[model samples]
Target: MTTSVSAIVIIVLALTALGYILGRQRALAVSDREKTKLHSLPGYYGQTVALYVAVPAFLLLGVWLFVQPIAIESQISSDIPQSIVDQSGAKSLVMADVRRIANGLDLLVGSGGFTETDLANMRADFSNVRSRLASVGVALGSDVQPAVFEAAKSYRNIGKAGSLIRNIAVLVTALALGAWSWFRITPRMRARNTSETFIKSLLMGSSLIAILTTLGIIGSLLFESIHFFRIYPARDFFFSATWNPQFRGGSDLGILPLLWGTLYVSFVALALAVPLGLMIAIYLAEYAGSSLRSFAKPAIEMLAGIPTIVYGLFALITVGPFIRDWIAQPTGLGSSSSSVMTAGLVMGIMLIPFISSLSDDIINAVPQSMRDGSYGLGATQSETIRKVIMPAALPGIVGAFLLAASRAIGETMIVVMGAGASARLSVNPFEAMTTVTVKIVSQLTGDTEFASPETLVAFALGLTLFVFTLGLNIIALYIVRKYREQYE
Candidate 1:
């Protein structure tokens, strides 16, 4: 099926390319091979023909591919015996087995290891179908039931027919559209206008897709969070100080502890990152010489390129232990190597490049006339920077800090490795703590049902995090807009 789909794609592309060439030639021929005799350029006519050939066919292909499995599964699911569903306790799981069996049979037949007739006649009791499939690299969890085998065979047959029909339909559509568009080509057809309209539609479609994708994500989170809140009390979730989740039952699914840990770690991170990063940006943007600035800027930005996991490891191995031994242990703050301070410091290091780069660009964007005007008024370079430059760039700098804050709030790897997954409400930064992201990961990690409040709480946590970050972004945007007019 994959090979067949690839073949269809290649054929569609070939037809599109052919349509372009033929459409160009037809336009030239109709204009008596004179370039200026046509209403638009020859390329625009070719593009129009190519779009006609490719767009509808690809759209049809995409829709067919998306809808086919859903339609087939719905049909097959209805046919599954109620007794099997009762035993399995989940129709989705049973369907999963059916898919695996169908895929195995397809592989077996494709590899010439078994004929369709052999597969149809084979009995699960006598033939050891699981082992046969295992030989073909399709491992099943259990022995195949007779009913399931029959369903698998039906699934394979229907899938094959669907693929065949899909291929034929897509090819026919492409060829027909290509021919129609080719015949429509003329010396005065305004091909440029038609092509430009298609391009505009394509750009609009790309923007719509991005917008729709964001809405889809928010909708999923909102729906699942609603489901979670229905199961768990919203008051307890929001106001309770404890953070505990049990898989069995009766869990105290609170947000306060996790929220505290998130804010604490992020605060520490930003506290360290903002001052140092701002200084670095000031030096790079205002004070550093050209040679030193080029080298220092890239070297500082290199911190951003390092993987978060690598930073996590650094926190876990080097920074965590160092803090535990030198600072926490000596001061009697906490003994745990994985502490909030450890994660925060490492995260701060990771965030330095983000803040510095953004702040540098923002400060540089401050007009030189402001600096010259300040200097003309008997101000030193330092006074000019403080009195004129920083104020002018304050809005953009605020936005950069808010962006870095968002990044810190969403960090997971460093928290996992450095801050240890212990959710507690405390003022001490030297203790092990867990953030919303870490808890989100832990809650959804194991084999748990989505219907369970324990699993659903992850969505709630995610939605809360989303809303918090969204608020931050809104504030940043408002500040930038308001102050931007003043600066301009």
Candidate 2:
């Protein structure tokens, strides 16, 4: 089976290479008589042919790979006994065993532990099939049933036939398409236009894939969120202050406390990040000398490269304890190490590079003429930066802040370790609280069924988070657009 897959891949590549060579040779042969008579260059012809050969073969391979398993499974699933299927509550588990046994048999044959004839003659009742399978590292649940074992053998035979057909079909498609393109190569051929059209379509398809993926995520969220709201009242979910999710049902799943925690932490983070990040950006872009800027910028940006988990660890071990002892304990605010202040401060540090780097680039993009005009009006360097450059770069700086805010709201690890998982509505920054993400994780991590409101609330939370971020982005875009229009 591995050999068949590999052989198909190798043959596709080989045909592609052959097509390139033949195409190039044919183009050269036609153009050798008079190069000026050719419609396009020889290279264009080769690229066109190669793409034609490779793309269709790869497309066929993809479709076959996706469809073959489904077809084989459908046929094999029907052959599985109804008794076994009903016992497992589905045929999937039985099919899984069949697949495992089939794979084990293949391995046994490949390893020379068994012959084809030996496997063909063997029956489930005649031998210790389970022990034999376990020796080959294929452990099955309970003793293998006779019906399941027979189905496994059928699954193996049918799968082999499907693979053989797939291999031949793919290779033939590649070679046939390659040969057709080869014969069609002529001096007047519009190979360049054809190739470029195909490339343009590919680019459009890639863009569409991204758009469709986003839509898919939104659709799933909306569908599940609706399901959740149906079982649990929408008014209570959105309006209530409590967020107590009980696995046994009759739980209070409210978004207010989680929203408060999220906004409070994000607000604290932005308060820290905006001023410091903007100052850093201003200094790096305008005040810092070239030598200092070169070293300092990368060093500052390095903070962005560090994992958030590492930052969470820092908060848990250092920041949280320091704040609890030096500030919270001293002031009699709160005793716990995990608090809103701990997570916010660490998240702020994590967001610094995102703000600073993006803001720096935006500040640098401010036209030199704006500063020159300010200087001509008798404004000092600092005055010019403050009056002219800052105004011009304000839109982009706001965009950076919005991005950092989104990052802060969606953060998980830092909130879990630094801000303990307690959903509450409180004004004290030193008190422990959790965000929507934390609750989403808690609600979905266990063995809860999708039909339960407890589990389904994760989707509602996710949808809420998505809408919040989307609203922020839309506001940022509106402000930026308005500012850009005024500036231009």
Give per-model TM-scores.
0.93, 0.84
Summarize candidate 1's per-residue lDDT along 125-206 as a digit string, tens digits. Answer: 6258878888899987766777878888889899999999999999999999889999988888999999999989988988
lDDT of 1 at 473: 90
Off by over 4 Å in 1: 33-36, 125-127, 485-488
Clashes of 1: 0
Where does candidate 2 clash, by residue pair?
none
* Most TM-score-accurate candidate: 1
Which segments of model 2 are wrong by more than 4 Å?
A: 1-7, 30-36, 66-164, 485-488
Q: After superposition, how far is residue 107 of candidate 2 from its true place, in Å?
A: 6.7
The weakest ten consecutive residues by lDDT in model 1 span 479-488
Query: What is the number of backbone collisions in each predicted candidate, taken in the order shown?
Result: 0, 0
- Model 2 / residue 303 / CA error / Å: 1.3
